[model samples]
Target: MTRRVFLSIMTAAGVSLLAAMLLILGMLQSAYTQRYRQQLRDEAAYAAAGLETGGTAFLAALPAGSGRITLIGADGTVLYDSIGTQDMENHSGRQEVQQALASGTGESSRYSATMGERTYNYALRLEDGRVLRVSAADFTLPEVLRSLAKPLLLIAVIVVLLSLFLALKLTRSIVRPINQLDPEHPDKAEIYPELSPLLDRLSSQSGQIDEQIRELRRKQQEFAAITENMQEGFLILDRDTNLLSYNTSALRLLGADDAVLGQSVLGLNSGSSFRDAVERSIAGEHYQRTMHHDGRYYQLIANPVHQEDGIIGAVLIILDVTEKDQRENQRREFTANVSHELKTPLTSISGFAEIIMSGLARPEDITHFATNIYAEAQRLITLVGDIIKLSQMDENSIPVEKEPVDLREIADFACERLSQAAAKKHITMAVHGSRETVSGVHQILEEMVLNLCDNAIKYNVEGGRVDITVSRDPRGAVFLSVADTGIGIPQSDRERVFERFYRVDKSHSKEIGGTGLGLSIVKHGAAYHGATLSLESELDKGTVITMTF
Candidate 1:
């Protein structure tokens, strides 16, 4: 800033000095040229008078001076020459001499080739048919300019030096007050009186700018806070596909660190498809994709941020849709299983009815066919009922009534309801525990206990023991555990043991004569009663399902 100010001052001074020098030189040249011409005229008139009065004796007697006196005959012959170069050139034929012959007096200026100098000439026609011309070597405009060069150069040097000195002083003087001004507290700074208005405006504008910056920062912080707390991953990218900002969720979802910021998305991971989608979004295309990565499912949505010119960046939102995807898969499987389950029973009933209608079976075999048809119909009814219950549980549409019920009594009732099945399976089942009270809907609790006991009997080994224990633990919660010496679930299958229509032994499932929804119902019912269900099972050892109320 200081250098700029100094240079500006020096430039102005130099230009002004140049203009003044040109003007003075022009005026001086004109005045000096005119004065020299006038002198030449006066000398010529005086000499002409002398020659007329004393003839050639006056010219011969005169001392030699800087002026040249030339006498030319009317017939273009040089009569006498004082400067001595008139030997070859006739003075009567000169422009001034010819003019003088025609009009009695003439003056002109020209350069002499022999003398190599310029001269001013004044010719006056004499009464004796001759011309008396006075000539003087005079400085031409070029010579005059040459004479002034030294002084002008000295003046220019002085001007530049003085301009430099003054420019420094002036620049510092003007800038000091402005530099000393405290922009943050402009009211307290001493400044020029003329700048008071500007200072006031500066102070006002400073406050406004500060406020706007603070507001912008505060808004940015608020946005950061909101995004950082979001469950879905949120990210912003620049037009170059570099990461501008990303939330904590985004970092976790992408398995990336904060170092990924300001880097291209491709550098963060091997998800080329994700990077491609981001590039497409930056090109003003909206993109969406569902990807399974790192044991979870995510839905990516990219939207371009467009301005008047074009897309400037993009906003990417990663949705953790793991649960949704799982639900969708479960629904598909349920549909397939429902079709298969219904088909099996319907086919049996259809085959038996066709056999009866065709009369292909003997009369004795008719009873057996009818019985099998009735059994198949009952199994179909059970499957339908289980499906309806599962749907209701999924919809959370069950009505609830909170009432205190004894866990021991529910276990007893469940065992009695499945006593025949237990007997048929030859499984020993008994309830042995202190009575514990729990507050929930009686129907839900009963259903939960019944399912657990039925599962214990259905999957138990022949003559295996089924124990129902209803008691309270140290936590003061009612605990009901149904432990069976059954074909235990495998470690891998334990996680999915409660899913609808999932049977561990599919080939023997029909022989077992049980719907695969027993444990699924138990899970839902226990959840409805606000009970925690835990399963401890081992292959070929035993399984225990405990419900803590």
Candidate 2:
């Protein structure tokens, strides 16, 4: 700031000085040129009057020293030459002389080879028909100008040097006061009023700053210790690739085992969920995600951070959620299983009561009752089997084991299992696909497919078409899609279709012996295999249940 102020002052002063100098030079040159021209004209007018008063004898030189003098006759002939001998031609053609003859006064400029410059000429024609012309060659004004040049140049140099010296002194003086100010109390700064003060606050502040720096260093060490001792991982980073700071817990959870200060978070872990979390946070998303590593699950909460300046960084707090997450997952599965267990029995009891109310007597009545009981029992067994399978998935991290089960064969078997039930409902079922070799627990996947096919047959209208399409999606993800042209589920119930104990038509589902846990089991199975479950349907139209694994 001081340098800038000084430079500005110097620039203004220099510009004013330069403009004044030019004005002075211009005025002086004008005054001198005018005086020189007037003097020469006066001399020519006086010399001409003398010639008019005396004749040829008056032109004869009585003067000791003067400029060139020439006299011409009335008929354009040179009468006399005082300065030098030269060819006498027509005086009427001479510019100055011709002008004097034409207008009674004349002036001209001519190249003087002797002076190597242009010289001024003046003339006056007398009443006696004689023309008198005078001219001077030397430029005395320029020599005076040359003398002023040296002085002006010297003044300019002195100004620049003095300005530089003053700028340095002022810069240093201002810097001392600035250095004295404490950053913490900068709003109320103190500066020395005197050129030299007893306090010398800059020196004092420097010492105090040194002490404060040591204190800050100690505080930083304590902060680091606190963060290290904290069980929850803490990570802070800017919007840039540079990671700011991380605690030991963060390093333990993530691959950044050591300090990642000033390092790129991207380079530390390539295939990590942390990278995704960071990207989302940088995009201004505040979210939490669970990541599992080495038999432990970490809940990472990515929150955006800001300072006085605005959004500059993000802080990610990581907490171990392995135990709680496992418990919650177990609870969800258990609840589903319990619901499934209760549903099948309830359906059986309701079906039995309905059959009892109907008045078919003896063997026919007994056969109908026995069939209904068997159907309920089979549904219960299927529900229990699904519950056991889902429980096994939560008890371990490794999948329930994979085998090359031709999905074609499984689909065939599922169809066979559900074929009898579909015939009872008078609903048609079919299986269609290409390659059917996939890796998954056969019993679980079989149940999932069978449940979907079973639901299609059960909910389907009498004689309604049940089309099972087994295929792979665009990403080569294998899918089992069971589409039915039946009284489809409503849009509002679509989201809860896979939820435990959730049914589209409550009364009708009981009548058809629905476990109400089939879709829930399907959902859990798909989740364990990292698969996606979805359904598209509209009321009174149709339904498509797809499971992609």
Candidate 3:
């Protein structure tokens, strides 16, 4: 804006100066030309005085611009002409001729209807009584104007070029110091004393602004660092919907892995709750809401970022509390499940004890009661062990070292171990194919494979077949499959099956004499090795569990 103002001022000043110079030059030329023409007219009049004797030889003595001399007799008949015999019949009506007849000398400046220019015409009547007339241009202005064309054009061009240079230099000088303030060397281009006060005011203002900016930057970095370090996501934007900034945490929380700055925000991070919060913040408001993404919950906040001018951008902070929330929920659910499990056994034990104390049970009955109590105690022990294992996995303190291992051997061993369990159900456990040694933690891999095979066998119908296949597929990655002809998992529960202590069939899990942490452990184990585990099953149909390494 300042540059534009400077350019406009320079242009106006330059044009005014050029116009004044040209006007002065034109007046000077006009005055000089008028004086020169008058001198020529006087010399012509003197020659006309010598031509009164009817001597045609007088034409030789005429001045320059007294081009064609004509002497008319007293009766208006042409007596002599320098060019040739007179073609016109008479010349008495000519202004110069009439003026000459009036006195010894007469002058007139008028447009010649015949010549098409204002000419200086003069004439005199000599003592011998013949009329002499002379004429010349009033100022010879045509020749002067033709001669001035080159120099005038040159001067105009020079003025325009000079104005352009001034516009460029002056505009830069004016606009530069605004956005780029020089604290170190403030006296660089001291413009003028009139502007000196403004500069001083600006200098003081800039000092204050610098301190403010330092504080702002410090706070911005603090917020930025927090956002970068957080596991949740964050974003900043303006009312124009242009992206201002985002942190690593915000990107992850928003699931925008490839977000770009200065672009529109709608392309990524288009989560509806997050978008609405940003819009509200742009109006200088703050809001917080819980939004769900990827089966998790996040608390998103939109805060207005302000400067000295006003609110500039909206800062968004996303915090992923899904893990913590889910943990609390799990804790509550576990307390309930444990209380329920314990209540049943405690009731039975109490009832049996009461029966014994009341003599309602004989010695054999007492032995049976003791056996039932011991079984229930073992169930509680298994359940407690499962809880500890689940907690250990949750801590994730142990890291795994992955390497190629013989999966065929591990699978064979696990099958043999669980073969008895399968046999009790009259189910067939079979190995479909063998695989090359794939890379993974030996212990985790073994546990995961064993758990899948065990689940497959345990869930199978009587006389059903359980097939385990291990091989390197076309993807060049090694995978293991455990399929079962069992009552398949329901679609709704399939997603929850990998959650800790989650069981599709609680009664069945209890009857099978196993902990519900098997699938959760397998999921964690797969995650530790960066392998993939997927399950596909339908109710009343078979199920397939695949692990790719």
Give TM per candidate. 0.70, 0.39, 0.50
| Candidate 3 residue pairs in clash (backbone atoms < 3 Å) | 232-249, 233-249, 233-250, 234-250
lDDT of each: 0.85, 0.76, 0.75
Best by lDDT: 1
Off by over 4 Å in 1: 1-159, 180-188, 257-259, 279-286, 303-306, 309-311, 347-377, 423-426, 430-437, 471-478
What RMSD, rounded to one decimal, does every model reach? 6.2, 22.1, 14.5
Model 1 per-residue lDDT tens digits across residues 109-194: 89977557888888999888788888888756677668889987898788778777877888788789998999888888888898
Q: Identify the superior model by lDDT, candidate 1 or candidate 2.
A: 1
Per-residue lDDT tens digits for candidate 2, residues 286-396, read 978888777888887887776675678788888999879866985796686577666757777677767676753465677777777776677777677666665676564
Candidates by lDDT, descending order: 1, 2, 3
Which whole-number lDDT from 0 to 100 does residue 37 have in model 1? 82
lDDT of 3 at 177: 58
Better of 2 and 3 by TM-score: 3
Report the poorest 10 consecutive residues by lDDT, candidate 3.
46-55
Clash pairs, model 2 backbone? none
Error of 2 at 80 (Å): 99
Model 3 C-alpha lDDT versus the unseen true structure: 0.75
